[model samples]
Target: MNTLFIFLLLSTISSTLGQESPDPVRDIDGNLLQSGTEYYILPVVRGMGGGLTLGPRSDDLCPLDVVQENLEVDNGLPLTFTPVDPKKGIIQESTDLNIIFQAQSICVQSNVWGLVEYEGHRIVSASGTPGNPGSETINNWFNIRKFDDHYKLVYCPTVCSICRPVCGDIGVKIDENGTRRLAISDVPFKIMFKKV
Candidate 1:
């Protein structure tokens, strides 16, 4: 009876571990892309508002090289700003900017805080109140220029604030059937850019 109990316990633990393990290929989206196979894992922190973090525990994926290349190709210039932290896995374009994600609402910092421009025009700027969540003054800060045609997006947690800009060499090809396709590579989570 003792032997049977031990076997059952061991089996249960094994099953639980297996179920919780992350499968790189079968579970990862954009894992089949042809670009390259380098991935970064982020952690999801509570009370941090919306957006996902990419470090160790978050479920966001990013195609670092590909994203950068695409942005450069569209803009006709390489990214001028460096990511905040590359080694520690904290990737951000500008640290001076703050984006807030509320329940069904989004807010940005302020124009007085300066702006992120593309092609000499203010493409990314903040125009919202500091503390008011539902005020119009807090409504338009989360703005992206060429919103439908051009954008620089990276894999971020599902909440929509935390984003990592992809750098390095990468390329993307649209299929003949009018469907957007990505290459297969190892990535922790998937980030996509859509015209909206």
Candidate 2:
């Protein structure tokens, strides 16, 4: 029927339009990033609430640093640099800055291990893997790429059971009826780093 055809056409058009492309890498305030400036990354849910920031000295398995969002930037986790040259521990394919963090207690760093879109969004089911002990070349799907206004977290159904970065793991979502949903590919988290 004509309705079916129209529906299909609209669907295709929307899909193409909504498709996220590589936007200019910006800081939490949607500003161009400085080379070596430090920024704090925090987690926030869509149309719901924010907080649950990743901080230092977190557990090796999940790294649940902060459960609530706070104005304190220094207390949150710090990320720096853009993924420009491959030889310099590139975060992803594009020239976005590579995240710089190291947790010696559990053998983990910003070195990612999956596909990362230029602007972190719509992570097509990827897993993060920490590379060698002292190296940051691991091809982890770290969708921590910068975007205007806030940092984005890639939707990953499956995450590293043992070690993961600040933006690696998915959080939990509970419905009004008390139904718990896995914050995998379903709900993506948009993060923001407080600027000093």
Candidate 3:
């Protein structure tokens, strides 16, 4: 009987250690982020332009790249988060999500955010189709991670078990035209979510 009790104790400990509880992402008001609810991703740092927005691309046929508004007062655009599991309603930290803009665009039918290779750099852009979460739409997967006291956007999709994706911290790259475009960088763009 003692041997059986010891085995059960060990089993309980091992199972508990294997399961990790999801960390809920909170907004500026300290409320948990609900999936499909509109939120504005604003920079925590004062002078880093405004929230995320779509910028004009030289090629009209291609989708617009995600950028920060040059003006300090501009809130940019509002976006919604859709978790990898369509049934999940809460946005959790480090979980794959689809960041979709609430605005309309004529250049692309879908305003879902996705990564694209432009000028030898991986940049975030629109035209992504969400809902299908896997290696098929890996580029469309993004996540919010806890950074210091705020949060930052990260591109590390785990939806595909066999696909290898370019994982990195999402930051801004200032182009010659002075546009602050979102790109993969060593330094992350510190951000915070504000419910709209």
Candidate 4:
């Protein structure tokens, strides 16, 4: 009888211990886990004719007669600048002519290095949409250098499909009246990126 009671007590204790304990296997990785990530949606503005030379055929004149003459010669005819309706054409131009080109979002992935804080190790992914239907993936190692109390980010070595070679230098300033501004040299589009 004592043997039977001891066997029942052992079986009960084993079953209770099994039910109280938790699972030992864990599927989480310690290194790959990230806590916080930052994002910046930078606006890339490209000036059309700032440093460019203004020639006779270029669209930099006020009267614009020389440009009209060149267009007439290219068309093989004397193109007369006759307004369809003079009354409707003589109006004040008040709207802003400066086009504002901006990017959607820029994703920057910051990974923690050895014994150091997360310092933006990799630009894992980049994407941009030039206000069009089909989007484009910007895949190239853009140069990020420091210049005169600011950082210059130059995106090149990759060309866009519709626009010209998307290249620019962004200066990041951290003082008062000093803000992050991008000066795209000749391109007519913007670039955006995000973290994956």
Candidate 3 lDDT over 56-163, as tens digits, reads 765454567799998778888999999999789999999999999999876755889898888989989887888787778999999999999999999999989999
Query: Each model's TM-score?
Result: 0.18, 0.39, 0.90, 0.19
Question: What are the C-alpha RMSDs, in order, of all predicted structures?
Answer: 18.0, 12.4, 2.8, 25.3
lDDT-wise, the better of 1 and 2 is: 2
Q: How accurate is candidate 2 locally (lDDT)?
A: 0.40
What tens digits encode model 1's per-residue C-alpha lDDT throughout 1-196? 9999999999999998886422112102432211112232111222212212111101222211111122212311111111212132222221211232111212222321112222332222223233222222222222111112222222221212443332211112233442222222232122222111
In the range 58-111, model 4's lDDT, one tens digit per residue, is 232221111111121121111111111222322111110111112221222111
Decide which is better by TM-score, 2 or 3.
3
Q: What residue runs in model 2 are displaced by over 4 Å at the alpha carbon?
A: 1-21, 34-36, 44-75, 81-98, 102-139, 144-151, 155-185
* Model 4, position 169: C-alpha lDDT score: 42
Q: Which stretches of candidate 1 lie over 4 Å from their true place?
A: 1-4, 23-72, 75-196
User: Whole-model lDDT for model 3 versus the true structure?
Assistant: 0.90
Candidate order by decreasing lDDT = 3, 2, 1, 4
How big is the positional error of residue 9 in model 1, measured in Å on the Cα after superposition?
Answer: 1.5
lDDT score, candidate 3, position 59? 45
Tell me the lDDT of candidate 1. Answer: 0.24
**Pick by TM-score: which candidate is best?**
3
Model 1 weakest 10-residue run by lDDT: 49-58
